[model samples]
Structures are given as C-alpha cells and as structure tokens.
Target chain A: MSLPTHTPVWRIKNSPEDSVVLDSSDEATFALTEEPVPSLEDGEMLVENVFISNDPAQRGWIQKGVLPERLYTAPVREGDIMATHSIARVLALKDSTDQRFKVNDFVYCMTAGWRRYAVIKTDPSACLPVMVPQNVSPTAALGLFGVPGFTAYYGLHDVLKFKEGQSLIVSAAAGAVGNVVVQYAKKVLKAKKVIAIVGSEEKCQWIKGLGADVALNYKSPTFAQDLVNATSDFVDAYFDSVSGVILDQVIPRIKQYGRIAACGAISGYNKDVGKPTMGATWIEVVTNRLTIQGFVILDFMFPKDGSNRVATEAFPSIAGALERGEITLDGTEDIVEVPFVDVPKVWGRLFTGANTGKLVTKLA
Target chain B: MSLPTHTPVWRIKNSPEDSVVLDSSDEATFALTEEPVPSLEDGEMLVENVFISNDPAQRGWIQKGVLPERLYTAPVREGDIMATHSIARVLALKDSTDQRFKVNDFVYCMTAGWRRYAVIKTDPSACLPVMVPQNVSPTAALGLFGVPGFTAYYGLHDVLKFKEGQSLIVSAAAGAVGNVVVQYAKKVLKAKKVIAIVGSEEKCQWIKGLGADVALNYKSPTFAQDLVNATSDFVDAYFDSVSGVILDQVIPRIKQYGRIAACGAISGYNKDVGKPTMGATWIEVVTNRLTIQGFVILDFMFPKDGSNRVATEAFPSIAGALERGEITLDGTEDIVEVPFVDVPKVWGRLFTGANTGKLVTKLA
Candidate 1:
C-alpha cells in the first residue's frame, strides 16, 4: 500500500482546567495540523490508522497538572499528540529482525496517538497483532474484542470473581465498558440478576435491551428508593464505573461479603485536585465486610510476568463469541463517528453522556 | 466452685446520645445493679466471670437507636446487659451432652455480658475451651492470646496477606488490637517499617516501645508532613483501627497495590446517626489500584464453616509466643483496672484516649 507524504495529527493546544469539554470561545484545546511524515527508523513499523478510540479517561489525560507518579502511564501534556488506542494496518516495516508483525497486517496499537498514521516499534513488547475473525465485523475488534471488553472480562472474572446465580449491579451500564460488563455478567457469568444504573431513560432502555434485568435512571426523583426496592435481596457484586453519590446509595444495599470492582471514578474526573471525592461511607464498608478493589486494564495487558492474558484468553474468547453472533453491536445506536478533524467536538460527547456505545473517530 | 446467690451485672441505664462517656449531669449510661442468680436450664452452664474485655466497640453498642441491619451485631438495648467477651470458669453444668467443657474448666465465652456471673449454653456453638499455658499469665489469655491478638493476626496475615519487607501503617497503635498489629507486623511479619499513628505523646512513646519504627502523634500540627517525611517510600499496607481524617492523609501516600484492613472507625463511633463519616477519597483508590476490605474478628470465629481458625491457629500461635516471652505486655502500662462499680466511669477512658492496652474490668 502506498502512503501519503503528509499526515494530519491532533496536538493538545493547552491543558484543560477542569473538564476536557472545550468551550467554543477557548482557543482550540486540540489543534489539527499537517506535518511531513518522518522516515521510519530501525525496529520501527509505519501504520495507517483506521480507528482511534475515544475513552472517558481522555478527560484525565488532558488535565492541567501532572498526575502523581504511579505504575500506569503518565498524563498527556500540552504540545503532545493526544494519546489514544488505535486500530491500524501496518503499511511498511523497516526491521526484519523482529517478525511479530509484517506489512499489510492489521494490528492493535496500545499507545497509538491521535493521527492518520502512527510509527510504532515492531517489537512484540510495543504492539500486538489483532486478528479479526472472518465472520465478525472489524468494529467488533474495537468494542467487544478490545480493551473495554477485556476490562469487563478480567474485572468480573478475575478481580470480583463473579459467580453463577449471583446478582450484580453496574453503574453507567450504557457506556462502552459498562455495556460489556452488563452483557458478560448476564450472558457469560449467568448472573441471576443484572441491574443497570444509568443517567437517562434512553440509556436505561438501551442497557435493558442488552440483558439488564432492571434499569434505573439515576436522574429520577425516586431513584434511591427504587434502588433499595430493586435490590431487596441485595447484590453480590457491583461493577462501578461512576463513583460519587451513586456509590453512597449502592453501597448500603450491597450484600455481606459483596465484592466491588472500582474500575473508574468518572464522576470525580473533573473535580479539582486535593478535594475529596464523594464516596460510599466507610462505616458501611466495615459493617458489611465489603471488599472494594480498584483496577486498571493496563495491569493485565502488561503484567510483570510478561504473559499477556488478553491475547491468549480474553481476545480468543471474545472473538469466538462475536463470530458466533452471541455478542452484537446492534444496540449501540449512538456510536457517533466524526471526521478526524472534528475529534475535539466529538470527544466532549463522552462527558455529556450524549454518545452511546464505543465512541471512536474514523481515520483513513 | 460455688456460685453467688446474687450476681452484679452492668446494664444500659439509657442509650447514649453523643458519647458513651456519661456527663456529670447525665444519668449513668451503664448502671451497676444486683439481680438474683438464675437457675441453669437443660443444656446450659453457669460460669463465674473472671475477666470481661473492654473494647472501643462498646461506644457503638450503646447508641440510642436501632442500627440498620447489616453483618455486625446490633447495639445493646436499654435494660439489656452490655455485651462483651469474657474468660470465665465453668462453675456448674446441666445436661452437658457435648464434652467440650467440665466444671471448673476455663473457657472463652463470646457472649459473656458485663456481669460477675453469666448463665451460658453448654453447646459447643456457644463457647469453646480455653487452654492457658503453664508459664503464661492468665492475663495473656485475655490480651495477646485472645480476641485482640486474633484480630491482628487474621487481619494482617489473612486479610491483608502482608509480606515481609513491606512497610505498614497502623492507626491507634497503642490500643489493644493496634498494639498486637504493630508487634506482629514488626516482630512476626518482619515488616521493613511500622509507622504508628497515635493521639498522644505518651502513646507515641508507648507504641515506639512496642517496636514501631516511627510513631506520629496524629494530634501534632505537622503530622501530615511528618507522615510524608517518615514514609518516603510509601506504605504497602495499613491496619486501620481509627478511621477519619487520618485516612484522608494516609491514603494519598499508599503505594500502588496497597492493601487496607478496615478493622474499626473509632473516630466516628460516637457521631450522630445518619451523619457521613470522613474516609479516604475513592479517586485515590482507583488511581492507586488499592484494595480496602472491612473485617470483624467474630466473622473468623463463627464462620459458616465449623472450622474456627482463631482457635486452631491464632490462639496456639499467640500462646506459644507469650510462653516463650517473645511477646511482652511491659509497655501496656495503661491497663488501669477499677472495681466493677466504676465500669461506667472507666469506660469513658477509651474514647478520651486516657487508657491504653486492654481495658478490662475485674469482676471476681
């Protein structure tokens, strides 16, 4: 395949103050500019980007200050290429020493920044080959067979150890990661009941269609009482994506020895530093003997053992499920795709709860 | 053994409104009264109480209203005997089909109320035999080889799975459970460092004497910075007996994959019902990938399975350690004993941080 001499890439213009949703009057928070493609160096492979994932974590990456040092990747700063996971096709390879990926092969770039083309290292340590089964759509690789899918799988199966016949509750059940969590809990784990907590009636209906036994709109005036009534028997596990007052309400209803997977705290993503995020009261935790654990998907992908379970276990399982038509993308009606140039505006949809399914930008 | 015709017992005079520490103008929250000894029924055993344990949980048990249903034992009601654990001698037995205990044998009663004599069920389900080593003092059975020691052992070794060479932070390090936690973490677990967060200078020195590498007076104005300075490498595990703002400070300094055993929240014990207790922000939990679990010792003692690990593991291990003089009670200087009549007054010492070690009332 022939490649263009120049490719357009989005660079963060300035750090966001609170929320990543940029205002129209504010100078471009992310600026699109064309640059000459650099020649590939030894051990590097050039890729033609197909799809760039728009995740809720993008809000945290663009925050004004640097995040405190931790095990995960560092926050993106001004003048940096807006960081994202991208599905791309390898156009050319410079080094023959490493044979993990070859030219014209489709690959999943874990750290592919927002650009039309990404120059990634050919070493298996840097990227992995993504094989989309013949019977499945390519978009399945971006959704149910991707990082979001693996997060829901590992979080419930590995972290929470969700068992068959146990009841589960998921907050933000209509979002990308949460959608998969609800499905996997109901379909794969055979959970007795799957309750979905969402923001709007539309999201409630959407998640309900995806096998949620009960859907409660958190915006309803009687939501708290509704939650209590719905979970009269109490839930055995809670997959939390939205923390804050939602946690405060759900935690009291968690059964004794219930496990909580704290996957994301999107509610506090935009809050100022040093300010306490609203959370479940610790008194409930102690009295109920609850176990709450926070996790990041990256840990499973690049564990210390050098074994990538996602490639060996999750990907094959999810891909086979998609190929068999057990998991469908039909319910994800609000996955609005925008041109690469309009990435900044579409990115804001994540925080506004306007976009459904997996939000991704199309790049050719 | 002969039983008294009349037994003196402490019962709740009225539920505490704020603090269990009764004010001068207030009626006695716990009142000492004399009652006729009840005759033993079939399958019941009469016990002469020796040592009744005083725990911080006493404050919560005396609260005015009914607690919301959860895993923990409910509060003792007005006109009811205050509940506590005690070491007592079996004075007499009736219809003792199960041969777990005989007359004059010592046993640990999980439900021996605050009384001079208690009528207990002889069923193995009710109480278990307590074997005190010849070389170990009887007090060792009430302290290091008892509930406090078992809580520390199970929480660190089982719940937190604390490994050697890892750092630990313990709140209320001078109290009964906290004392054992610090000693076990330092001496048995061989932790790299043990940081003790206490309330007073006396407690600072006391816990330091118990082998705490660092003791920070939480009341110190510069305690937060002192914590940062002391734990330069960040803590790997925390045994939290006192939860409140202290959690807010320590949580931010926890290393990635840090574990927290939420044993107690003494700071909020006397707070008004329905008021929120301050706790570690959940954002840090997510960002740090931390695991926080709440536990009570009774769960381990009376687990659904008939196996009681506390009896088979903790008691024997702790008793052996005490017999070998590996664990000492020398620094526990504040175990001030008073007459049973002064129980209500001395009970206030717990909340006031005026007493240390195991605060037990002498009933014989």
Candidate 2:
C-alpha cells in the first residue's frame, strides 16, 4: 500500500476572540493549506478521516476570552491545526509487531484536526483511534456514541444525580448533547416530565418527538411565559446547555434543592461564555439549595490504566438501549454532510443555526 | 415561676429594603413596644430570654428584593415581631404530660423574639426550646454550640465535602460563622493550609490566633495582590461567607475540582444579594468542574419527624471535639453583649464591622 506524503489541512488564521463575537463563517479566520504528513511512530497508525465532527464547541476552541481554556478541551491555539473528533479508517500500521489493530479498522480519533489524513495512536495505549463498535454505524462514533453522547450520559446521570420519576428540563435540546440528554431522561430514566428548550419551532418539534414532554422555543416572543406555563412551577432537575438568557429564565423556576448539570454554555460561547451569565445568580442557587456543577466529558474520558471511560462505562449501556429500541436517535435528519474542502464555512453553520443538525466533513 | 403579663418587644417598622441597602441601624425601622403575652397552649412553654443571637443573616431576613424570601429563613415582614436565636430559661409548661422540660431548664430557642419574655414549645414536637447540653455554659447555646457553629459544621463537612489535608479558604473569618469555619478547617480537619479573609487587621489577627495559616484583610490596599501571593495558585475549597468582592477574588484562585460552600452573602447583603456577583463566572465553574452550593442551616435543622438536623447530627460531633480540646473557640473576645432596647443599632453593627464578634442580647 502506498502512503500519501502531502495532506490538505486547515489551521486557525485569526482567533475567535479577535472578533466582536465568534464568527466561524469569516473565512479569513481560517487558513487552508497543504502540509507534509509525518511518518507515524510505533503504536501509531495512519488513518483517513471518514467523518469529522463540526461541533458548537469548535467556536470556543479556536477562540480566546470567550470560554476559558480547559472547559471541555484545551482551546486550539491561534496557529494550531483546528481540532476535531472524527471517525477514521486505518490505512497503514506503524509497528509490524502490533496486532491489536488491522488495516481498515474504523476508529474514533480525538485529535483528528481538520485534515484529510492524519497519524493517530491506537489501542494498547490511551491515545486516539479508539476502536469504533462494529455493531453500530461508524458515524455514530462522531455523534451519539461519541463525546456528545458521553457528555449527556455523565451530565444527566453523574452530574445531576438524576432520579426516576423526577421532572427534568434541558436547554438546546435539539443539539447533539442536548438531544441525547433529553432521550436519556425521558426514555431511560422514566422521568415524570421532561421539558426541552430549543431555538426554533422545528427543533422543538424534533426534541418533542424524541420524548420531551414539553418543548419550548426559546426564541419565541413569549418564551418566558411559555416556560412558566409549561413547567409545573418548578422542575426537579435542569440540564443547562445554553447558559445566557435561558439560564436566567430557568433559574427561578427550578424547584428547591434542584440539581443543575451545567453541560455547556453554547449560547454565550460566541460571547464571554462562562461568566455567570444573567440568570445563574447565587440567589437562586442559595435560596433553593441548588447544586450547580459544570463538567467536561474529557475529564472523565481517559483513565491512566489505558481504559476509555466512555468505552468502558457509557457505550455499553447506551448502545444496549439503542439496540433494544428503548431510546432512538434521528440518524437520518440530525446529521449534515459537508465536503471536506468546505470546512471553515460549513463549520460556521453551527453557530448561525443555518442547519440544526450535526455537521460532519465526509472525506472517504 | 410565672410568665410576665407584658413583654417589651421590637417589630420591623420600615423594612430593610426601604433603603438602598440593608440599614439595620435605622432606629425608625424598628419599633419597641409593650405587648400582652399570649396564654400558653398545649406542648408550649413560656420562656424568659437569657441571651439573643444576632446573626449576619438577620440583615437578609428583614429585607426584601435584596434577597428572595426562604433563603435561610423567612424574610421578616413589616409589623412582624423581630426574630432571634437565643438561650432561654423555661418559666412554665402548658402540657402537664410533657416530661421533656422543667421550670428553670436552659434551652436553645430557634424563634425567640427580640423581647424580654416569650412563649416557645419543647420536645415531643419540633417547636423551639431545644434542650441545651449541661456540660457547656448555657451561653454557648447561642454561640459556639448554636446556629453559627452548626452553619460552619454543615457547610464544611457536607456542602464543601471538605477533606483533611486539602487547602481551604474562608471569608469573614472572624465573624459568627466564619470563625467556626476557619477553626474547623485548620484545627479539626487538619487542612494543609487555611487562609482567612477578614476586613480589618484586628480581625486578621483574631482569626490568625484562631488557627488560620494566613489571614488576608480584604480591606487592605494590596488585598488582591496579597491573596495571589498567599494562595499557591489555587485552593481546594472556599467557604464563602461574604460573596461580593471577596468571592470574586477567591474564585480564580480555587484549584481544579474545588468546592465552594456559599454560606452567606454578607458583603452583598446590603446590595443585590444573590445575583451572579462579579467573580463567580461559569468560566471558573466549568473550567474547574466546581461544585458550588448555597445552603441554609435551617433546612437541615428541621426533620418531618420533628428532630433537629443540627441538634441530632452536628452538635454531638462538634461539641465532643470542643470538650476534648481538639478545637477551641474565643469566649471573651468574639461575643459582644448588646442591650435589649438596642436591637436595631446592634444588629446594624454586624454589617458595618463595628465589632468583629457574635452580637448577643443578654435580656436576663
């Protein structure tokens, strides 16, 4: 097999913080160039990027002064190759003695970057190229079975201490992690009530179909009153993904001793993301004895013993539920395909709400 | 023993919210009047106030808008009798069948009013007159063995999930709850390092004497720089008593996965109390994966079965430590004796830092 010497890649040209707000659509902010692909060391494999995930967090990654670094992942430096999570196909192995991975095995890569081909280390170590389960679609490695899903799992179960029959609420419910959280609370936990907040009516409808008892369009003119009418005065738990205005609205309505899993601050990711945006005040937190926890999935993703936290703990249970048809994901509608070369502009669509679905660059 | 027919009492006249900030010193805000004492009912006891506890939270309970009602206790309504936690001597018992109390028994009262004499209830029900231990001075029932110490115990052990050997920081370290928190962290928990934030050098010295490894005067000109130098980049836990400027300063210096016990908002009590103060941004929370909880000692103080969470759980453990000399409290210096008629002015001193001590009304 012949190995490719040059790879097409994108790097951060201008930082997101340099802009008034994060504008991923500004092509000048991203640089597309060709770079020599370095030879892989032992335990590393050369993989072709099959599907690269374009996440809302990407806006924060290539930015500064918005969300601080080390929230979920370290922010991509000003001139660093843009970071990505992707499904990849192994093309060649670096070590002849390494039998853990065979050529053409589909794997999930954490540092895939915005490249057509990359070198990633595989199993027997806790690097990248985590083998994708063959039983599910490989694309799920970048979506439902990946970081987004794992985030939902931990936020709902571990962070929120969610219990069965409790009423739960989620913001950004149609987004990658939010949808999974809604499904898990409604279907798996059998929550008495699950309310979801989304930007558009279509997104609201989509989440409601995923078993949300009530879906509120946050962009609606009557969103605040709508939330009040929909909620039974207060909810037992709140899974907050958007932490600006919606957070403020949800704060007063959370029941006393309510648990809030602050999974993401997507709404403010383009702005100064993590300052206690308007509504997440200490008053509500104290008055109600609320427990607000901010967590990053990656913090729990890798264990020092070379075992993957998600692979070892989350994937088994969630995948089993998927196979049993107790919880379903909208595979056909929630994913958008973009050409590998249109990376920057297509990635920008995430913040613009141009498409309310997971954006992925398809290379192979 | 006979109960007094008329009791000299104080009632909220103007309400703290009537001013720009909580002005507990405004004499016009309180009205001292003589009221006919109500006859005792079944399971009730007539008690004479011995020592009334004046807490920083008193500024919160008598105000509106600054803090929402139901923070630690109900906000004192205008024209309502002033509330105080006190040490009282039982004069009479209405329930002849009740063997829990006897004349001259010293007890802790949760809802003792700012009056010379009042009617409370004792055991077999969750009314006031919680029996005080015989081993400690009855005065300790309103100070070290009372609500302030209990607040510190729960905030340290439960809310912050504080562990021995961890670095801990506390604000208002010489005040009612803060002093106990500092002592618990340093003397009881054996923390690696304990830093205290107080307003005055006098308080700084007092808290240092109590066992703080370092005490920073938040009122100092170089307070901010001093904090950065004293903290080894970050601390493991912060017991935040004053949640305005001091809280903002401490947030960035807390270590990864640090816990914050939001005990009180004394600094902002006179301001817009519970909104996101300047420093507690979600950025710090998310990046650190922080668990910030706001709690009231009262919530746990009462059980549906009528047992006190504090008396049952916290007192036995802490009082035993005190008796064993594992920890010591300042008896002479930290308690300020206030006259009964000076309730409004004395309570205001709590906010002004006029006296860095637990203010108590010695009615007897």
- Two-chain DockQ for each candidate model: 0.34, 0.33
Q: How far off is residue B359 in model 1, in Å?
A: 2.0
How far does residue B194 in candidate 2 sit from its true spot (Å)?
Answer: 0.5
Q: List the candidates' TM-scores in order.
A: 0.85, 0.84
* Model 1 docking category: acceptable
Which CAPRI tier for candidate 2? acceptable
- Residue A190's lDDT within candidate 2 is 88
Task: List, residue by residue over B292-316, the lDDT tens digit for candidate 1.
Answer: 8988888886777878787688877
